[model samples]
Target: MPLPDPSLLFRPLRKLYRRLPLPYALRVLLGRIYRRIGSPVNRAIQQRILANSLFRPPHCHLQESLDSLPDYLFWGVIDWDFRHQRPQHLAEQLSLGGRRVFYISSTLQDDPRAGFALRPLDQTGRLFEVRLFARTAPIIYHIAPDATLACQLRRSIGELLSWANTHQVVSLIQHPFWTPVAGVLPNSRVVYDCMDLHQGFGNNAVELQDLERNLIGAADLTLFASAWLEQHWHQQIPRTPAQQWAVLRNAADFDYFSKPAQHPCQAPDQGPVIGYYGALAHWFDVELLAAIAEAFPHCTILLIGADTARIGARLRHHTNVRLTGEVPYRQLSAYLHAFDVCILPFRIESLTMATNPVKVYEYLSAGKPVVTVDLPELHEFQQQVTIAKDQQAFIDAIARALQAPASSAESRQRQAFAAQQTWQHRVQALLALTEGTQQQPRVSVIVVTYNNLAFTRDCLASLTADPQGQPLEIIVVDNGSSDGSVEFLQQWATSYGQTLILNDSNRGFAAANNQGLALARGEFLALLNNDTQVTAGWARTLRRHLQRNPGLGLIGAVTNNIGNEAKIDIHYQNSQEMAVRARQYTWRHAGLIVPCATLGFFAVMMPRSTYERVGPLDEAFGLGFFEDDDYCRRVEQAGLSCAFAEDVFIHHHLSASFAQMPGKQRQLLFERNKALYEAKWGRPWTPHVAREKP
Candidate 1:
């Protein structure tokens, strides 16, 4: 019948393929090939098939399961079953601390029936392993996601959140693959957990490096696995706030590793066992291990973990060396009990230099003597670990470690030190940093007045108290107001103890605002038109967004009357109605933000750091026709975003000062500023239009 449908024929083939017991390695290779050759429709069909396999309970059921608990979704770098490392440890600790965690794995199941599975990882049901089934999985491990794949992943994540009715989320990103998807989650905070020098992998280095820079710039808190990584990136991206980054080194599960092995290793009859565990990747020092095997001819050298670099042939000839492939995490302690000395033999490279090995901490927890190459991170643990500079020194250190007794002072001291550096402690510090428990950030409000006495008084009165109880520093600039505005401001300043700047002549809007900006002392700065009256919690809401979204440099408030996209239709006729309308709108669109190319400066806020980087607004814009647009363009150029908070509504008596100017003069000012902006940027300006209501 018109050539049998291709999908119908392939359906049987797909079923047959799923029934076949294919090797995992082969499946992974096939998945990679499919990613390269599969059509968008085929990939989408595969994702849908996977999604259908999961047992998705009712929304209310999922909601009740995680009632009143905070959520942390980890965009994981490795699978939960893969080597239990930093990502697993952190997720486990957070879940234990009364937060529900969903760890999305990089590894994808190949079987069609294996769909997107959400497996509970702990008995408490707080920890989950989210297994995504898609052919694009292998592609993301080394490179960033393409647009199509990012859209697909975002939809999948949105679905998962909807099932749980998650309102607030903290996305803990462990790899650069998730960089493009950062800050897209609703009411979410983003954290970049930098565990490795990703560019050192040498597979798509340029793309990886670029993505990392963007991730660091956008993350609310970027955690470095080592102090060296923190300092290195700090120097690289100096524009980012110093407080935005912190060093959170890898730690071990002390109780798990410290417990004596239930079954001891069956040693080779005569000699001691010198062991090393973890991934045998490119950075692994195979040459050093070979040398150690040759030097310790009498000893048995055991290597555990997957051999990803195919270095087994090089070590096979060493009769005394043994390679025990990947072992389960629970069984690792048994091997650790048999070792006379544990070693970290890594080459001196950019990657290794930045590594803060998790195995070192685990080794110490088991009270084992440790020997490692001269990695910078080990210098702090030199007393607990032996640092060897070369192959000869490594062998010598191993010999010394073997000679030390099991219950020696150094062994006991190593255990004692590791006890204090548990994963629980690291998670506690991380929670404190992400929870915004530090001192409240100060806000400086600048109201540029030009004879709008009533509006100015209302704006000033609204600032008397802050909803968040943060210290407020109000700075009022009277730009040659002749309606007794300067006298009123002087008396108001005297009464409120606020700063005042008086101009003898009518300075342009940009100039007057710049004068106020220069005297601003708060960590956050806001430019408010004297014609607008702010609502309660307006400043706090804007500051909260800035704190939660590091990528957003400048944010403006939605108002009832504005010329740009920020203007939303309203039905309020008086101040009382206005307050009620604002409250209703805010509740309906809580935490909603609309990213825009330009944000009006009628009521805009930005951090002090952003102001410092973008500098003051262009004075050439004169009376502020295109000054906001120019500043927004500069912010975008500096790799930041501009958006308006849909939840924060202010009352604007539109253009109170500009309306007083004669029509001809106002038109002349707009034309001149438009020409200046076009000439400076070599692009035609796009005139602002009101946003269409949905």
Candidate 2:
């Protein structure tokens, strides 16, 4: 079989996007501002009206901390809202995994004058957000020499930097565009999730070479969706660090296909149905499918998918072949479930050799036995898939699968194996590719301060007062205070040989804390508020608890000012009073720790591994509010618990920073924060009185 023409497959997509109407120098400026302001509220109350829409983005939800976003900015090989592909599958699963996913649809389906449009994919909001840029191509497959067109596209794309920065997007996973516009996205990593050879693009081969080079050099990891492609890419590019490249095979959306077929349709009762769903492209073996149809004249061959190219008269003329045409990806499960056997007859050509058919895995999820041409890529799925060497074998395999009981152990094994290859599993592997592999420190204590020099001084004094000799590393981040807090802390940290990070202004609690966290080197990180004075041995006690319960993600001490469950019978009159009561409380409840779902970050400690898994605090809450609650919830999602160190006591000067603000501002902040928290977690924040056993 000859190699498929790239122009036939992808050029039209570029044409579609280029026809749609559509930012760049704006990118450089926005990137600069975003680094300072974090994320501005997406207050676009009006939706961009359009003539036609393949998919729409949802209205921006009320601010749910920047931390809640999906770790990736997914740019599908085509529009995500278009045909369901690898990116869409991964994005859907990742979204269900609790990360906000935004699919970049570009402006392919809209008019050149169309404005931006946003609409929720579903009421549950787990379907992922899709946005289309007016005047942009469905997929930018080729690089152009026209800088003006590029600028307009990037300037429009630059608008998303706020989303990128606000979400602290860790990676840009998709096609590479050359410009500072992409550089402005505040993403720590980039992934050229290579599914096909860049050389596959018909035109602009030279430009494609440059683009791939840029992507390869810029990408922290280049994960191939197929093993053959992984090896092919390696042979093309000069060998780099092997760790930077890996194979993350395409998998099915198990949850989607596992759902019993809805609105089931009965096929010809006498004949078994053999189904196939995918674009009828060059890689598809028309001759092979024709032969199968000839050998099994009684079997109904159901071809369910878009006919991207011309279909051969041979298969089209088959009396038993039923071309149901294209349907939405969500509806494909119904067709698959209606089948007794599935087939993936691909031409044994260069185009098919390296391809990994996503639909085959999806078919397996439905327990429809798959018979396919024996290709290198199919070997990976050999355990679950039947290798069809010839027309006779293909016919025999389909007959066997059709004859097998629906609930037979063979069918169950196929389903079980596909379940393990869900988009969730692949997403876990994707995340591993997007993170750095640095050796973390054993323990790092982080403290953020806005003002209140006395509270800050007292807090530091008490923490240092206890000489535990445990190699305790302290990091103090000062969020520009009008008082002499920065200067004093700078000098103090220097004298004590601790780390000090200074910010120009009060960037808010989450931002400041995240900054300190970025600098931390320990395996364990304790977030201590500047207004809290720790008791002697408080750190030692919490660290010991973490050591004892290796599985616990969060361990925080009780304080008189906050944490209803952690509060003891003491309020601070002064720093002197705090010191006295701390010693007394420590003796009263020694070695007592209570397991709880929620804990205060005021003096909470967690392992660096937990931080890596759950990520930094959400900066969207602004100035210091419910981000800690968000953090705890994220920790819980990671299968870890937050426990209170009941035996330990710390003194908290509640609302010390809020004291400087006017009453109205403080109240407004509280109301705003409360609303956001409710929207994100639906927590009522009903203050509970500490319940102590007699």
Candidate 3:
């Protein structure tokens, strides 16, 4: 017998992988491609491609964001425990602007329950800290080999946002991995911060580079810290009409660091103090520091802050060098005052090449004479400070800085420059994005149920438990539910001020939803299924996004058991797991509203105008099989866009109500509806047995 083909043997596995929920299989493919391309040149090309495709400029604005921005949610890259990078400075300033901030740390906590640890980020009592404690897929956990962690974090954050009663979350996130969560956050205005280049990612160059492109595509605004980074992204990433972004160089915290220090006078053995404070590692340029220490044996060279590697060890034994193992932030000013001159001796590698050093302005704030390496980020800082091209040039620049007057006209210019480069200004520039944006509330939910009382109960329970109490009118059209659902709904309507449409018999999905449509008063109308459980604040979230882009005619959230791109397996084993997964999914794709052709009525939200224009679901497709498609086609003809809100997740029990009917009858109706739908829309509406993702 001939040997069987290998393609047949592996085809089943490939098919199984492909069947995995929306984006999961795609992410897996990206991960595999990333692993295969080990060469740096190929990796750079891949990185460029990812940044181009993955990232996006801002697409939506918040209420009064142009006039006066509200509270913020920061998908921060740096933790306070790590470097006090741009996010920290901007968040504090934004809080000072009378807005609360929830800074999400990049470090994932080990405990799942610890995912949402709330703590005070600053003494102001306004800025809060929330951590994303995502479970890692050990062997497969290669940064974002897939959106596993992104999905996990996004879901949890969504729940947290609902529970906190925080809507209209304007966020600034750096990592492309966390961009999905930014997409899913309620009424979010996401700005993707390009602080560093892929080459600067060091060990994570490939993975982070891969994710950067998607982050660009997902963000409503893309911000580049350096012109170098902006130019590179422009060269690599293709522009979209929806992509809106700009460049803003990193600034310094002048007010906090500018005031002259009161304590810690010059060191007892100081010849001329040359101090460097920041992380000490590969970027520290140990050889240069050693060269400086050797050249100036009489001068005291101070190295402050923590060390990640053995680079600090080598500097410790130098006679002229003093390594002060990390000092409190409060004492940093004093330490700066103690230094006669400040120096940034960095390795001229890809990492340093792209860095807009946070210390440059800090040094200027102290009015200290500074010397640094030749960096593209420092091109604007010329004439005030010396830029060294090599070790010899570095030594000469430091000598020049030391020789120059500490408070000359050049020094005054430096201080003036630093004063203008404050965090307050950076934040204002950031918020300027929301200029002339209109905000409005819009959403009416219409749920249809047959006999699935259990799922209906859970759905109402979730809807009723909304923390924000955002104004939403719930209308339930009982399609002749016999399992006490109508009774429960009657009581629910009486208690909760919901609109109930009573029918004596099954009116089918189209007629029932049409019945609810007649009663809906909000700007947007949602058609939901009784057999599906809505996550907390599902209506509110859907409404926020519908308001996000007014051009959208209809929007549907992803579901646990929905078909095609909307399907996501949240690994539901229990109610807690369900909640966890739902929240994660919500936060992960919070801002990602993709233009779609078809939206299932199982849980779909559409504008009131769309319904008025396209009219209700066609009752022609009886028993509700392809009415949604026919309606969607009409919407298309009306020149309105349909979209999928990937950030929202609903738990669907998989045709629970439909499964109860006779198989032949259900099949017959489905065929009849398919025929009616195809006849009406000039396209086949058959079961998607061999279909491709749209």
User: What is the lDDT, from 0 to 100, of the residue 581 in candidate 2?
Assistant: 55
What would the C-alpha RMSD of candidate 2 be, to one decimal place?
20.4
Cα lDDT of model 3 by residue, 167-186, tens digit: 34677776665655565565
Q: Model 2, 80-112: lDDT tens per residue? A: 566888877787666666656666663343334
The per-candidate count of clashes, in order, stands at 1, 25, 34
Worst 10 residues of 3 by lDDT: 54-63
Predict model 3's lDDT versus the native. Answer: 0.72
Q: Tens-digit lDDT track for model 1 on 1-694?
A: 1323436635876788788899999989877876676555675665565555543432222323333344888988788898899999999999878888889887654433323558788877678887654445655656677765555565456556555545356788988887765445544567899898887885644676788887787676889999888888978886444347788999999998888888877666577899888998898888998899888898888889899898687788888888888999988988898888999989899899998999999999999999999988889798899898788888888888888877889888999999998999999899977765434478999989999798888888767733223457889988888998988999999998989999998888899999999999999999999888787568767887897789999999999888888999888888766766775565345556899889988999999989999999889888769998899999999999999998688898888998999999999999999999999999999989889879
* lDDT, residue 104, candidate 1: 89
* Candidate numbers, best TM-score first, in rank order: 1, 3, 2
Score each candidate by Cα lDDT: 0.80, 0.69, 0.72
Q: Model 1 misses residue 387 by how many Å?
A: 1.9
Query: Number of the top candidate by TM-score?
Result: 1
Question: Model 3, which residues run further than 4 Å from truth?
Answer: 1-70, 112-115, 123-125, 136-142, 145-151, 315-317, 434-694
Task: List TM-scores for all candidates, in order.
Answer: 0.66, 0.55, 0.61
In candidate 2, stretches whose alpha carbon ends up further than 4 angstroms from where it belongs are: 1-59, 67-71, 106-115, 124-139, 142-146, 163-167, 177-184, 201-206, 403-406, 435-694
> Model 1 Cα RMSD, Å?
9.0
